[model samples]
Target: MTEQKRYAILPLIAIGLVGGLLSGLFGIGGGVIIVPALVLLLVMPQRLAAGTSVAAILPAAVVGAISYAVQGNVDWTAGILLAVGIVIGSQVGALLLSKLPVGFLQWLFLGFLLVVIVSLWFVVPQRDSEISITVLTGAMLAVTGFLTGILSGLIGVGGGIIVVPVLMFFFGANDLVAKGTSLVMMIPGSLSGTLANWRRKNVDLRAAAAVGLAASAASPLGTIIAGTLAPSMSNILFSIFLVLIFTQMLVRLIRAKKN
Candidate 1:
């Protein structure tokens, strides 16, 4: 491998390792971590970064969902219903993305990330066990999925931040089940959004593949590690990751304002 390719390997592995653990622990798809890392480490353009992140998320989420499923943590009925809404919402969001300026979209994504970080830090509910999903619960799930899908398409986050919180707070899902369900919902939405971006030549297939393969390979180990961590420790790590990302966004936004 050339110098650039060699340099990319470590980051790819790091992203995969960290992203998978986060996904397994938090019910997040790792897009928040992946997108910012790609931008900071690889100097990838925003559009390609988003697209590649989405692409990598597909496999990572799959691995995460499967792991959670084996632990009897998946709620297939709710997951599939939510996914239906997510697919439609993602398509609409992609259409909107095509009309927006790239800079505006970047700012929007940064703003969204800030909101998620703050919410996860300050407002997320505390609970240890899984909650049951009813018909009423399914309706709420659909709405959350719809909004998450829209954001996923716009920001390439695969909707994990939104999905996890909703499942935890509103739907009353346990952390493990919520994470698994989020991964399940993310599959179709990410795939759809990625295809939309791919049509616009925004996806870097080679880079995505490199990162995704590593992520898939490492996800089972990450999931096992996640299962070992205390919930409080997992929350702390997740909070720190969010704070770091939020700080990065703040710096970029300030720099942009100055420019």
Candidate 2:
């Protein structure tokens, strides 16, 4: 590679490493970190940055999911139910995106996050023995996943941000289990999105490789830390994460309005 190209690769890897840590720690796809870092640090265009972020997310999801699964935190049936809903919801969401006003969607997403924060603080269920899934529980998970997928498609954010809270607060899952299940639910969605981006030639293969590999290496460490946190502490961390994501969306919306 040229000297300039070589220099560029290091920062991508660094961004991916940090993003992956956050992903494993929080059961996210790390697009929150990857997209902004690519735009600001690598001077990538927003569209391409988003596409590349999707590509990088796939490996991070896989690595993180495996770590969570190894700990017996993943609920496979729940994850599958959520994934099924995501597939349906995402198709509808993509169809709707072009017709919706960006500002409106941004406000809506912010509102959703606020509601989630309230639920996390006030409505989160007290810890008890792990709940076994029934038909109703599976249905609830599917509905929550569908809603999360719609928002993810419309806003270009990872569905995990929505999935984790719903799993915990609405479905009565413990924090670690919720996060792990969210990671499992994200795998197929991320892969599908990334593959579509690749087909469109939107993904930069070299950059994606550097980011994905770095994320894979760092994910286990983050998962380890997450596994060790208390349930209440994990909920606190997740609420803070939601607020941060909400603020970012608000800022981006304001910027778009200006231009």
Candidate 3:
């Protein structure tokens, strides 16, 4: 491999390992972590980072969904319906992103990341049982999916952060079920966003594939580990991860302000 390729591979593998663990534990797409890290560490351009992040998210979500499915945690109907909305919304969001300025996009993404970190830190808690999906709840789910799709298209995230909280808070889904459903919902949105980026020639397929494959291979292991943890232990670990992510974002924001 060329020096540049060799340089990229190590970071990609590191991203895959951390991303898979986060996906298994938090029901997030790992793009929130992966994209920023790529930009900072790999010197990847923003659009390329977004596209590559989406591409990598595909395998990670698939592996996570499968693991959750095995535990009988997936809600197929909800996932499919949410995915449909996500795909449509993502198309519109992608078009809008192309028109926006780079600075604007950066600030917007930072703001969104802040919101996610705050929500994860403050809102999510361990639930005792699954929530019943009522008519009102279904409508809310559709709305959340639409919003998440737009965000995903704009930022290259898989919308899992948004999906998980909504599932937990509004739908009363258990953590495992929320994680499974979020992964299932991500498939179509990620595909649509990735295709849009591909058309623009922004995707780095080699990097994406490498990271995706590694993340997929590691995800089941993370899920198995998650299953082994006690409820309190899992909660504690997840909280620590959230705190770490929040601190990273804060440092980024502070640096941006300084510069």
Which candidate number would show the highest TM-score if scored against the true structure? 2
lDDT of 1: 0.74
Model 3, TM vs. native: 0.85
Estimate, for each residue in 61-122, the C-alpha lDDT of model 3 and write its tens digit: 99899998998878887787689888887776677667764455556655654665555545
lDDT, residue 123, model 3: 59
Query: Taking the tens digit of each residue's C-alpha lDDT, what string does model 2 give over 1-259?
Result: 1222332878998998998898899898887788878887888765567667766877888999999999888889999999888766655554455456546866877898899876776654454525479989888878877876666555555688778777776677777777788888877776665555555545576787789889988888889999888766777777888888778777877888899
Off by over 4 Å in 2: 1-7, 91-101, 123-132
**Maximum-lDDT candidate:** 3
| Model 2: pairs clashing at backbone N, Cα or C within 3 Å | none
lDDT-wise, the better of 1 and 3 is 3
Candidate 2 local lDDT, residue 223: 95
At residue 2, candidate 1 shows an lDDT of: 18
TM-score attained by model 2: 0.86
Q: Once model 3 is optimally superposed onto the true structure by TM-score, how far is the C-alpha of residue 143 displaced, in angstroms?
A: 1.2
